[model samples]
Target: MIRKANISEIDQILAITKACGERMKEDGIFQWNETYPNAEAFQKDIERGELYVYISEDIVLGCIVISTIMDEEYKSVKWLTPNSNNYYIHRLAVHPKHQGKGIARKMMDFAEELAVQKNFVSVRLDTFSKNIRNQKFYKARGYKQLENIYFPNQSEFPFYCYELPLKK
Candidate 1:
């Protein structure tokens, strides 16, 4: 089941992110590390009621943040969809041990459904340029790749922005 994340789940959420980071590093992907997606970020996300977690058998398998707020950096991109009334996706993470079980896909499905219900024009997100798997995943879901954005603290490489238009 997917539901809003509680503050108490922060520890499990952090663990999932940590495991995911370790797994990515093992595969030579430096998308996440000790800095980005830290506890503070998740805490703020929870406080804002934007963070959602995927649970199974009482375990927090994954998490995703869907919000109407976009970062200032997004304003610089020439997006395919209009800026207003859009949903921005962030911190999409699935535990390595529970991966390949379609948890991430389900979370995305939930997010998109919520977007449609909220009359959002599109769903916007970013993927690490070096993470080919993630890039392909979003592209396959019809997310159009736009220009790149940078998170200097996370990696030297730029992150690619993507948008999936919900309205014609």
Candidate 2:
């Protein structure tokens, strides 16, 4: 089940984030680090009602943050879709054990569904440029690669943004 994340689930959310971070490091992806998606971040997400979790029988399998709020970095991108009606996806992760079970796909479907429901024109997100698996995943889902933006604290390489236009 996919639903809005509550502040009460902060521990589970943080655990998921930590596990993902460790797994990424093991796989050589430097997307999240010691300072990212921390407790405070999740708190703010919950307060803003932007965080969602994928659960199964009361166990948290993954989480994602969907919002219309654009980061200053996104402003410089030459997006194919109009920026006005787009949703931004951030900190999407699935527990390592729960991966390969189509959890991420389900989450993406949910995000797009939410966008349509909210009258948004598209979904926008960025993946670490070095994470080929993520690039392939989004590409296969019809997300168009836009341009690269850097996170000085995240990686030496740029993060590539992708946009998927919703069917009218």
Return the top candidate by lDDT. Answer: 1
Q: Kindly list the per-residue Cα lDDT of model 2 for residues 1-168, writing each as its tens digit.
A: 999998899999898989999999999888899898799988988899999999999999999999889999999999987779789999999999889999999999999999999999999999999899999999999999989998988888999999999998
Off by over 4 Å in 1: none
Winner by TM-score? 1
Clashing pairs in 1: none
What ranges in model 2 sit over 4 Å off? none
User: Candidate 1: lDDT of 22?
Assistant: 96
Tens-digit lDDT track of model 1 for 78-119:
998777999999999999998998999999999999999888
CA error at residue 95 for candidate 1, angstroms: 0.4
Model 2 gets an lDDT of 0.92
RMSD after Cα superposition, model 1 = 0.8
**Can you list the residue pairs that collide in candidate 2?**
none
